[model samples]
Target chain A: MTVDLRRAPAEKAVAWRRSPAGPPRASQKRQTVIRQRQYWGRLFVLPAVVLVSLLIIVPSIQGLYYSFTNWNGRSATWVGLDNYINGIFLSPDFARIALNSVCVVLSVPFGVALSVIVANLLANNLWGRAWFRGIYFLPIALSWVVIGITFAYLLSGRGPINGLLSSVGLGMFSQDWLGGETSALISIILVFNWSYFGINVVLLFTGMTTADASITEAARLDGAHGVKMFFNIVIPQVRRYVELCLILTMAAAITSIFALIYTMTSGGPGVSTTTLEYALYTRSFSLGHFSQGAAFGILLFLISLVFAVVRLRAGVKADDD
Target chain B: MTDRNSTIETDTSNDVPLSATPPRVAPPRSSSAAHRTGGRRVGDRISALFSTGLTRIVLVGLAAGTIAPLVFMVFKSLTKQDGTNAVTFDAWAAVLNGKLPQAGLISLQVSVIAILVILSIATLAAFGFAKLSFTGSQPIMATIIVLMLVPGQTFIITEYFNFSHLGLIGNIPAVGVLYGVTQIPFATFILTNFFRAIPDELVEAAIIDGASYPRVFWSIFLPLARPAMVTVGVLAFIGVWNDLLIALLFLPTPGSRTLSVVMAGAQDTRTFDVSQVMAGSLLSAIPCIIVYVIFQRQIAVGLTAGTGK
Candidate 1:
């Protein structure tokens, strides 16, 4: 492929030389320009290549190697599959943590649904639509630490949620939202959706604009309205966007809930809120089990890899269309 | 696909009835049709009004839901935590006068450095990928895009091991470098897409004027890509400023910790003050929120640039 791409410009130069109007010197100059461009391209990309390789690529490979060995920060001994088998799979807390991760993944559908609904609603020609978009997207501006701290206070026993419930005489419905094992996980999921659905809404709204307006109008004239129109006409049009949202939400849930879990629950209330990423941190950094942490990291990477591949394939297909 | 079939069915049904109607009864049919259409217009008006009202209500509710938590955070930061209902500025005062300002300064320095590094490296790479054709460019670009999806957490352990071995764990600029490197993939992706949209004729015109490649990039591409550069810079700045993981892992000491790390640490203490922590959280979030409000359009463009047509 590289060879073909390289030779194509040269072939074009040769074709130019065959034309009576094209002087030989101009073709020679064109070849030199192509050579200069190639040289500049390589020069410009050099720094990025070096930095990414040293920081990301090299360490990732080293991490894969470390996952198989008993590497404790200092020295390493080849322990084969012991870290994966005994350190992770056989550990008592692994099942619960994996379950927590699964729960996070399950929340993606709800988030995607909310985003699609909200995006559809906002897609209409309405009053203050831009203001609503800005408001919905406000949380994306805040850091995860700030979000975690804000929610940690909001879901506490004496927080405004319970306070409002008590004032409204529905106090029984209000519990410590982040206090229990199940409640903490649920709270984390809810917060995750709340914070991230904004960006999804933006993506889906962009998708909605790309829908064939004439087709939608045709569908409307054919006795389709409201839910039927949305599901049958609009949803089909934005299917790729919906898929993109699902993959992004799932990937985020799997990998990027660290700060939220750290601040809100600390994987606490007896490890009910601990996802794989959180477990990776605790086992490796806090407990000094570096190899075990490496193993967990690999597990997390593999899970995310599935979504990445799906997204890449979808992207390629979209490009083809 | 189902909608297309439904559309065809409705089309044929309406078409067959119109074609089968006789011309002799057209006048009477026209009069009755006008009456039915008038009544249907009124009904349609009412339904449109009703649906519009419903949409307005739902939008208002969603907007309120989005803002309520941030508002509550601000309110909690101001009020006393003893259920006394007395408003106090002590938490804010403490956050400003205590360790947070210093932490904020550290975060600012790190972000500034990261943005500089990202802007310089990502812009050149993006321009190269967009305008200059070279051997292996396609594969290299694909690798960069793939790296964009891989979370930084996957490599944190290895980075820690490496950084520790190099005795650079607590180095502030090293953290900035790591932050800058992780962000290069996304920044380059956005800028490359932006640069590719600019017409190639402009580059050829500049070249025809005897401008060298670097000169063309410096004078032509740089001027035209200013907005994209700003978008990349703001995003890179926000990303570095908002990151807690790298800052926490690398700069573990009290003096070098970023604002987020300090805020997280404050929350972890058993005797932590709730109002003060809330104030601190708000304090750390202020810079990012301000940046977001100022560069809202660029941020939106940068974010959705890759996802849409």
Candidate 2:
């Protein structure tokens, strides 16, 4: 009891020191503590710095150099702007893949909107809530490789999905989902949303379920209820989560859909579903054009780097506040 | 706590927790409040435009929509292609001798090594960022944030080139090291927030008693940060386990094939057997699905940690 009593004053002093930050206000011992924090902090953070630099920093510089070369995974000569020029205008394949990546961005609003609506549904007062959550989030746990196969099986011409449609007299609506040019990109986007929507649903529902109770109650008492209360009141609170979901989903779409596309379509139907990430893979590893692939990778890196900068700036500023 | 861990948490550890930890303790409490919404489909049998049964039916349908593909894949893999969908292990039997299981073993080996590599690197880096205060710390962290923003695609080409140059291609441990390297920034970011949540008094008191920083860290913080470590470790596990492209490029040989690469091969023009495809997909997916089942709640917390709450 006495130990607690004696420690209380020191704790208070520490708290006091924290509330009003200034070197002028700190005692000699407190100053030492701050110095200690700084020394140890630097020691801990540097390995990650060195490691990340090796992994990404050095490689990115090498990638930039490779972009300016005529290298095909072998010896090379300088080929300034040739790759970029081809990537932007001359190469029809590159342009198609670039457009397909935009299709990923266009697919985002559907995902976010559907996730929000379903999250609201799951947040309702109901039995079997946990079961529903488990079911919805199940796909999020599966790898893209697995989701790709599952979709491929279902969308095949003689698959069970078409069988079910035919049994129900709806066979005309079920085409060879992954076999056509026009429908192939749409199918990719749809499956992409299917594979991931559960994650965002759980994410948004977690945010919505955790909104301030008193505020929600206040809104309820003020005759704002149902969809109106959800839109007008609850959404503002969970908007940060919504934004986080957007940034993450957009990033994943840009660089990480290679598995799904590679497995399901192989950028098929004459490159209908080819996104930039897939193009990068085929150009480098498949076609043995490492330099061109490096250029494509650089282009995507710059795009995602922009998002990363915005997020980091916001993160740093938020920390300051 | 164990129930929550079943949810698999590391997927969202990328967000640097600008706001810190204590705020996170309260989120689950509101999940209970979600159970108490006013007359909004209360009594489990009350509703408006449609009866509650209809709502439940719709919900069950939606749930089926999400998980049916996985269930279908599993059953199809275990069933015979004898035209009657009779449950048999023909696909499973064939796949066991095929490349799928071999690639699975490779993935298992790689994921284990990658998890260890990531944990060792991320643990100390996170501790430093969370506990050690130094000049330029903020700027250094900001740089990490920006580096993280650069997608893996940005570096994969050159990384492949460098690895090929070094002849590290098809080497499982090298890919493991790469996995660890890619994950450091995010894991460190999560661990730093978690480490910062430890009260300063304990460390200060230990320091005053003539204890070294490493001693205090190992003795005090490591034990306290166990859950966070598990969370970060499992998150890293998911990342390494789920990857396909880099592993495919780096380990192109048939013998070095990882589970995802083998699954990708299922769709190749040379082989179009649906059962083999499903079987390979299951082999690749089951580990992550099992992890998710075991760590469901922890996964949600880790995932949400960087949402700026």
TM-score, chain B, predicted structure 1:
0.83
lDDT of 2 by residue, B118-137 (tens): 77777777777666755566
Clashes of 2: 17
lDDT tens digits, residues A18-66, model 2? 6756553555466566656666666666677887888878998888998
Candidate 1 ranges with C-alpha deviation above 4 Å: A1-24, A315-321, B1-47, B82-84
Question: For residue A81, what is the lDDT in candidate 2?
Answer: 91
Shares of reference contacts reproduced by the candidates, in order, are: 0.60, 0.73
DockQ of every model listed? 0.46, 0.35
lDDT of 2 at B139: 77
Q: What residue pairs are clashing in model 1?
A: none
Model 1 agreement with the true structure over B1-309: per-residue lDDT tens digits: 345345534543454355433432233444345544775567767987898899899888878888898887788789987779689999899888899999999999889888988888888898889998688888998898678866777788989989999999878888888889999999889889888999988888888889988898899898888998899888888778888878889999888999989998898789788778888888898999999889877877776665654
Chain B TM per candidate, please?
0.83, 0.81
Candidates in order have lDDT scores of 0.83, 0.77
Winner by DockQ = 1
Candidate 2: CAPRI quality band: acceptable
Displacement of the residue B264 alpha carbon in candidate 2, Å: 1.4
